[model samples]
Target: MINTFTKPKRLYQEIGLRLYEELSDSRFSVGDRLPPERDIAERLGVSRAVVREALIMLELMGLVEVRKGSGIYLIKQPTDNSLNNELESTLDNDDVGPFEMMQARQLLESHVAEFAATQATKKDIIKMREALELEKQNIEVLDHNHDADKLFHLAIAEATQNSVLVDLVENLWERRESSPMWKQLHCHITDQTYRKKWLIDHEEILLAIQQKKPDAARMAMWRHLENVKDTLLILSEHKDPSFDGYLFSSNPVQI
Candidate 1:
C-alpha cells in the first residue's frame, strides 16, 4: 500500500519560504515591483487569494509594500533575521485556542460586512454576485474548499473599500487555516445540507449588502458567524481528542 498523507503548514508560510528562497538567490532585487497578484498566482500554481495572503504576510514583515492601484514592490534589502523572526514568532503561537480566534474574526468581519453595505459599488455588487454563484456550485459538490469560502468573505471585505479591514480578515483566515481544529472541522463537515446552509447565509448577507442595508448586513453576518462559532465549538469538542475546553467553551473577548 502506498501511504498517502500530507503535513500541514500555513499557506502564507509556504509562500514566504518560496519568496525567501528567491530573495536569497537574488532572483528578485530590492525595489523590484513584484508581478500582479494574478501573475504570481499563475507562476506559483496557487490561487490569487493565496498569493494575496502571502503578500500580506510579506508586507507585514516589511519585505514588500502594497501600493493600492499600483502593485506590490520589494522593499527591504534581503535579510534573514527579521523575516525569519517574524515567521518564527507567527508559527510559535500555535497553542492559541480556535474559539478565541473565531471571536476575533467575528468582531472584525461583522464590521466589514456593515461597511461593505454602505461602501460597495455597482461593480463590487456584480463581483459579489459572481462569487456567490461560484460558491453555490462549489457547495453543491460538498467539497471543503476553505479557500473558496474565504474568497466569498474577502470579496465582501474588498467591497468595503477598507484596506485595513481587508488586510485583517485575510490575515485572520490565513491563521485559521493553520489551526488543527479548523482542519478537523473541514474533515467532519462533508454534508451538503451544512454546505448549503452556509451558502444561504452568505446569500442573505450579500443581499443585505447589495441593498446597502448596513444594519441588516451587519446582523446577518453576525448571525451567520454565530452559527459558525456554534458549529466549530461542537465539532472541536466532539472530534479532536486533544482539544482543551478553551477550543469550545471560551466566551468572546469584548472588543
Candidate 2:
C-alpha cells in the first residue's frame, strides 16, 4: 500500500488553524470577544500555552485584537492578502530555506548579543566559555558539536533576560535542524576549515560580551552570521541546479 499522509503540525499550529476557521465561519463576529485562554484551552483539551500561541498567530495576522488585561476580540477577517502572507509563513515553518533562517538569525541574534553584553553576569560568561570549550573539543574530534554550538548562542539569549527573544533564538535554531536547505548546505562542509573559522568567530563574540562592549558584540555576531551566509552561498554555487541553484542562484549576496 502506498500511504499518503501529510506531516503532523505542531500543536499550536493546529490550534491556530482551527481558531482561524472559526473566525472565518463567522462563529466569532467582528468585534466579538473571544473566550479567555483558560476557557478555550479547557474546551479544546489543550494547554493555555497552546491557546496563547494560537491567539498570538491570529493577532499577528490582524484577525484578532489583544487588549491588555481585558480579552481577545475578533478585529477582522483574514483578507486575501493576509491569508497569502500567513500561507507563506506556514510554508516557511514547514521547510524554511537556509538563507531565510540565516537572515532571521542575523537580525535577532545581533541584538541578543548586544543585550547580553550589558546584561550577562559572571555566571553567564562562564557557561558561554564552557560551551565554547566543548565546541572546540568536538571540532577536534570531528563531532560537529551542534548542541554545544546551540548552547553558546542560547546562553547569550538567556543573559538578555527577555523570554521572547530567548524563544525566538530557540525557534530559529530548531528550524535550522529541520530545514532541508540547511541540511543540504551542511553536506558540503565535510572539512574542518569552516568549523575552525567559526570557533574563532564565536570566541570574538564571547570576548565582546565578556568585556561588556555592546556595539562590538553586535558587530561580532553580525560578522559571524554574515560569514556563515557567505559560506552557504559559495558552497551552494558548487552544487547542481537541483540542489541549491533553484532558490539562491539568482539572488545577490547580501551582507
Candidate 3:
C-alpha cells in the first residue's frame, strides 16, 4: 500500500482498484448486484464515463459481470492475489479515455476541417470522395478497423499542406487504435445505427470543404464528433435502470 501512488495510476485504474477492494468486504459476495453507474459516479466524485470505464476494467479482470438489462453482479470474489495480478497487468494503462480522445479530436479536427476548406484542391476533393465511397461500401459492417474513416480524416488533414498537422492527426488515430480501454468499451456497443449517421456526417463535411465554407466545415465536423461521442456513450450504457434510459432510478452502492 505504501507504493500505491509510486507508479502514478491512471484515474480509471485507481477507481477500479478501489471498487475491487470494496468487493472483499463481508457485505459483498459473488452474485450480489453492484450499484448503478450514476450512484457509483456520484459517490466516487467522478463522472459516469469514468465509472463506466472502471467497470469495464473490472469486467475485463473477471471480477464482475455486466448483464445488459440487469445490474452489474459480482461474478468472483476478489482476492489480494488476484487484485495485485490484475493491477500489475493493467496499472500501467495511461491511455486517454475514449471520451477524452473524442474531445481532443473535436477540438483539433474541427479547426483542421475549417483550414481544409481554404486549402483543398481538386485532387484533395477526389481523394475525399474515394474515401467516402469506400466508407459507403463498408457502412453496413460494424466490426471492421474503420480504415476508410481514417482515410477520409487523414485526407482532410493532408489538404492543409502541412505535414505537422497530418502527423498530429495520424498520431491521434494511432493512439486510439492502441488503446485497450477503447477496445474494451467498444466491445459493449452493439448498435450500428450510428455508423450510418456518421457516413452522412462525412458527406456533409466533404461538401462543406468542397464549397470552401470554412464555418460550415468547422461546424459540420464539430457536430459529427459530438454525435459520435454521444452515440458511443449511449450505446455502451449497460446494466441498471440506465441501460434502458431510466438513468435516475437505479440503486446506490451497498456499503
Candidate 4:
C-alpha cells in the first residue's frame, strides 16, 4: 500500500511533520492554544522562523489558526483519514522554501542589475525611475502590500533587454504569490519599518545602474539582498548553544 504521508523534503516541512505527529497523539486537544513560538523553538532546537514556517504549514492544512499578536490555535484534529488530504494541501502550496526563493532572486537579479548597468538605455532608466517613484508613494501611504516593489525589480530585469531574464524574474514572483508558506511567513510580521530600509537600498541600486557601473550595481544588489535575508533571519535567532545554525549561508560570497 502506498503511504499517503510522504517524507518531508524541506526543513520547515520536516518540522511541520514532527508537529503533526505530536498533534495526532493525545498531547493536544481541539481549541487548545499551543506553546509560544519561542518556547517551541527552544524545545525543538530550531529557529523560530522554522517553527513559524511549520505553524504555517499546519495553518494551510486547516489544522490550526494563526492569530497575529496572539497565538496559534488548534482548529481541526489531524486524523489519519483526513491527514492524507490535509498533508497534500500543505505540500502543494508550500513546495518552495522562502529562503531558497530569496537566494535565487539574489543570484539572478544581482547579475541582472550588472547587465542593466551596461545595457540600460535612457528610456529604460526612465521606466526604472517611474517604478521607483511608485514604490515611494506606496511606502508613504503605509501600504502593507507593496505591489510596486515587484515593478521596480521587473524594471531592473527589463533594463537588461534580455527577454529571458525578465521572464525568469516574473516567474519567481509568480511562485512567491502562489506560495502558502510565503504568505504565512508574512502574516506574522506586523512591522512596516523594514520598508524604509529597502527603499534606500533601491535608490543605491538605481544610482549604480544609472552610472553604468556594472561592478557597483552588482555589489549594491548583492548587499541589498543580503540585508533582506538578514532581516528575515533575525526572527529565527537560536539562543541554544547546541542548536545548529541557519540552513542557508549568510555570506556565501566573500566580496
Candidate 1: 10-residue stretch with minimal lDDT: 1-10
lDDT of each: 0.67, 0.72, 0.82, 0.79
Report the candidate with higher lDDT, 1 versus 2: 2
Clashes of each: 0, 0, 0, 0
Model 4 error, position 189 (Å)? 2.8
Q: Which lDDT tens digits does candidate 1 get at residues 203-249? A: 99999998899999988888788778776544322222332333222
* Total residue pair clashes for candidate 4: 0
Q: Evaluated with lDDT, which candidate comes out highest?
A: 3
Candidate with maximal TM-score: 3
Off by over 4 Å in 3: 1-9, 140-145, 242-255
Better of 2 and 3 by lDDT: 3
- Look at candidate 4 and tell me the lDDT of residue 189: 65
What lDDT score is found at residue 103 in candidate 3?
71
Provide the lDDT at 50 for model 3.
72
Ranking by lDDT: 3, 4, 2, 1
Return the TM-score for each candidate structure.
0.56, 0.58, 0.87, 0.78
TM-score of structure candidate 3: 0.87
- lDDT of the structure predicted as candidate 4: 0.79
Give the alpha carbon lDDT tens digit for every residue of 1-255 in model 4.
233566777878878888887888757899888887667777998766577678777877889886544567888888767666768666544467676678789998899999999999999889878988888888888877667788889999999999999999999999999886777667656667888899999999999999999999999999998888777755433223333444343465665
Candidate 2 per-residue lDDT, tens place, 118-210, comes to 999999999999999999989888886589989999999999988999999999998888755466446545555687888899999999999
Clashes of 3: 0
- The regions of model 2 sitting more than 4 angstroms off are 1-93, 239-255
The Cα RMSD in angstroms, rounded to one decimal, for candidate 4 relative to the true structure is: 4.4
